[model samples]
Target chain A: MATCCGGLKLDPAVREDARRRLLSVRGHVDAVLRMLENDRVYCVDVLKQVKAVDGALAKVGNLVLQSHLKQHVVTAHERGDEDQILGELMEILKYR
Target chain B: MATCCGGLKLDPAVREDARRRLLSVRGHVDAVLRMLENDRVYCVDVLKQVKAVDGALAKVGNLVLQSHLKQHVVTAHERGDEDQILGELMEILKYR
Candidate 1:
């Protein structure tokens, strides 16, 4: 969250939003853990909670990726840094 | 998944598994789209399904990151490619 968004010297607002959602997940996960509630950790309800965190993280990932594409990739492309652009594209392909 | 796992020239098995799970998401999201099921897309069941895919993708991401750490980063460090290793580390930090 920080790295992708951070790399761009992006607005702190965007970075903070990602941080907040991620922290929410961490806080919830910690609460769950503190309760020692592993009885049905893999059940639907628990899975839903897990999914909430996952979804949150994925959204953050998408934001970071979008930022990368817009700020880093496009800039590199515009500047004719073909090799770096290719490297970035190749890196993006791996996350497919 | 492919790119992250691919950069290291890992075993095809790992790559295939990531592809499979990703394809499953594609199939499912496509199926849902075909059925025009966005009316209740934000509901619990749908969110649960969304979470499943997110969870799977996160796991795949973890695998790719781990492979990169072991194969690329570790290997580079071993071979004294400190600069590349730092670049990789910095890249990984953004996905936090």
Candidate 2:
């Protein structure tokens, strides 16, 4: 059932890294949520959170994009179905 | 030469609404940025900002998405080049 050669179990270090980064991102989310809940609108504070969230999400997004490009994109390019694959890729890009 | 009948000039209220929403979003980003700059990683505050930013972005995204669906999507569906347009649509979706 494995899609790629890499096993389902990510390396411990990688897992930890992802966890830490995810927690960091979550922390930021929490802060902003608190502000909103209290109705204490701090524009600057919210802006900072957005930036941090963006940065964190970007990192994760790049990782996913890299994998997609390396695997699916490469395969599609070689299989003569680049158009179809490219279309799919474009759709996914829209999500960002 | 206009893409749609609606003029580019959003109604004053709409314009104000967009501006207020955008500014609110920016304000959140600024707050988070300040925290990062000072190395004061307040997880709760940051989290709140992330949520607010996401909400604001989602609202804006929905507006754009509606237009894309109404304009390009409708046109594509009628043109009998569904595959091509679908592909393109998929690709654009990929960005999100």
Candidate 3:
């Protein structure tokens, strides 16, 4: 197992939820590709589908972030890993 | 064919490029799913991968938006579609 900071693992339920959401996002991307391939698709319609995928992906990110906060961030001080946790949080924030 | 606003179609080259990028993003999402499934995955590492997918998806959106601007927005007045074009532009801006 890839030991995370503070030696805490992702909550199992959260991990499963994220995996499921990611798969749905993958399917959403496939739908957008199909729209692009069609000869008569509207630009606005394609944009809407693209936007939907974006929203879905954002949700996935939120799910992971929430899980990380609950499983790792919440317990950082007691684990004596507050500095490492803070650094990791800062790194993830850059992507947001 | 689904006629787009102003009767303009997406440029074929741009459409193909967007499709290719979307496929790559789909694969990227699959990789994230694999990471989530692994017993030892780090939350920060998983988050970084998710962020990479977000960036890639944004690039796909930009490619489509650029093509739309070039093919449709640029020629709207000449085609007497300024009002419709404006509405569509506003709608897309909400997504951004």
Candidate 4:
């Protein structure tokens, strides 16, 4: 298990899953670009694609957040980093 | 002016701007993938980047929506496509 910042762990499987999803998202973005450049794409259709990308990104974020909560938040007090963990959680939420 | 579905117009400049933003987003997603593969990135840090991508996508969606509203929705009755325009708007909202 590799440690990230604050010595928190992110499961390798979870990281790999996130990477795969992001790659797909990158490709999806490219497809949207092609639609914009080549096709006389409808505004509603373009909006649908943009929303799909947004939804995909949200899922990736959730995967990371879930890993963090499972691995770090659960054991914060034992590791004596509760405040730091709490603050990090708050930071992520603020953006959402 | 080119017409999209329902003969709605999307401003050329707005479409160009969206293309540029989506290109940036594609690159950003690549960067995040690199961070995951190489750096022992903190979960919170990754979340911030993901949120940034989401924000950028939202801005692009807004640009498209704005164009639709200005060019199509406002003139729906004149074009006799009010029902179609209203339905499309509702579809986009359902996703959000």
Candidate 5:
């Protein structure tokens, strides 16, 4: 589903949401770093802040994965391009 | 300063810390998904969980980056391998 601006598969609402999520994560990261450097933070407190950042990252990853599955995977399956998906995912796993 | 563990520069303590951070993030991710699926969760609640996950991920990334800089980047600069470091980082950025 091409939008008026471009050929991105995600809807405008989703795109905006994703952007906001990324920005929020960036803010959280900066805040955590500042707290670590500028404040006499306890170890457990720092860990808690780190935990929050990771949770945000995971949620963003989930959202993007869901969007990809709906927009790309389903289309790929419909077109019978199972091998492409498999290869791409496998390559990414290998990167890790 | 290579350690006894096959020339890795990071101390065992750091390795353990990184592993614990990763595990904690995984737990948070699971909890968030569970809440999303099984609970009548509020949007703000879910977003907060997501934010935590992102912050955790950022912390992990920062830890790894700091360790690598102290171990690898500084060593590379000492050994006159600036080009390798630049190329590798550029390749990763290109992947994104």
Candidate 6:
């Protein structure tokens, strides 16, 4: 448990997986930026690369969600904080 | 076209559309974070919110791709730089 965050920490394996996924996503983002800078690349080809980057990012998001669920949400339930957290989550979702 | 970026500028309408979409995605992300912090919320409910956030982000990604295609890709073709740009894009896609 990480006291500062007041939630359980991610399992070591999950943390490693998340790290790798995040780095992979970063690499994809950088590549996309370089493609945009190069003058000879076709517009359609760039679009395909952008799609790849999007997929990589979505995967990373999944990793984060998985870690959050295992580390924080589970622990919060034992502490009886689920209702307040749910409200906060709902508030965050209400964009308009 | 903007000289600083050396690409065509986004149309005013597309830019406005992108702005709105980005803000919507941001709101979703914020909501997801809050959901994680709350303890009373069920893990399953938080998962649903995360899915909604993912969808919003995907839509925002589409907007970016649309703007980039219309603004940058079309202009690069006029400059006879499609070949180089195409190579760069292909390079970006080769992440593995």
The best candidate by DockQ is: 3
Candidate 2 total steric clashes: 60
Model 5: chain B TM-score relative to the native chain B: 0.75
Question: Highest lDDT, which number?
Answer: 4
Listed models, DockQ each: 0.03, 0.03, 0.60, 0.52, 0.06, 0.09
lDDT for every model?
0.45, 0.46, 0.82, 0.83, 0.52, 0.52
Clashes of 5: 20
What are the per-residue Cα lDDT tens digits for candidate 2 across A1-96?
112222212233333443455556556555544543333232223333445565674564454355446645677656676786577557556635
- Per-residue lDDT of B1-96 in model 6, one digit per residue for the tens? 112233444355544554465455555545544544444443335445555655654564566566666666666678887786566445644642
lDDT by residue (B18-83, candidate 4, tens digit) is: 999899988889888987885466777788889888998899999999997898789889988899
Ranking by TM-score: 4, 3, 6, 5, 1, 2
User: Count of backbone clashes for each model?
Assistant: 8, 60, 2, 0, 20, 16
Model 1, span B1-96: residue lDDT tens: 112222335444544554465455445444423322222121122223334556565665565456546656666756676685566557545534
Candidate 3 chain A worst ten-residue window by lDDT: A1-10
* RMSD vs true structure, all candidates: 18.6, 15.6, 2.1, 2.9, 13.9, 9.3
TM-score of each: 0.41, 0.39, 0.91, 0.92, 0.45, 0.48
Residue by residue across A3-74, what tens digits does model 6's lDDT show?
223343445554455446545654554554454454444344444544665576566456655666666666
Candidate 3: give the clashing pairs. Answer: A2-B40, A40-B2
Which CAPRI category fits model 5? incorrect
Most TM-score-accurate candidate:
4
Q: Interface RMSD (Å), each candidate?
A: 18.0, 14.5, 2.4, 3.8, 13.5, 8.6
A9-93, model 3: which lDDT tens digit per residue?
Answer: 7778888888898889988888888888887677777777888888998898888789899888888899889898899799889
Whole-model lDDT, model 4: 0.83
- CAPRI band for model 6: incorrect
Candidate 5 chain B lowest-lDDT run of ten: B1-10
Write the residue-wise lDDT of candidate 4 on A1-96 in tens digits: 223556665667888999999999998999899878844667888888899889999999999999989978898999999998898789889947
lDDT by residue (B16-71, candidate 3, tens digit) is 88889999999989888888888777777888888889899889888888888888
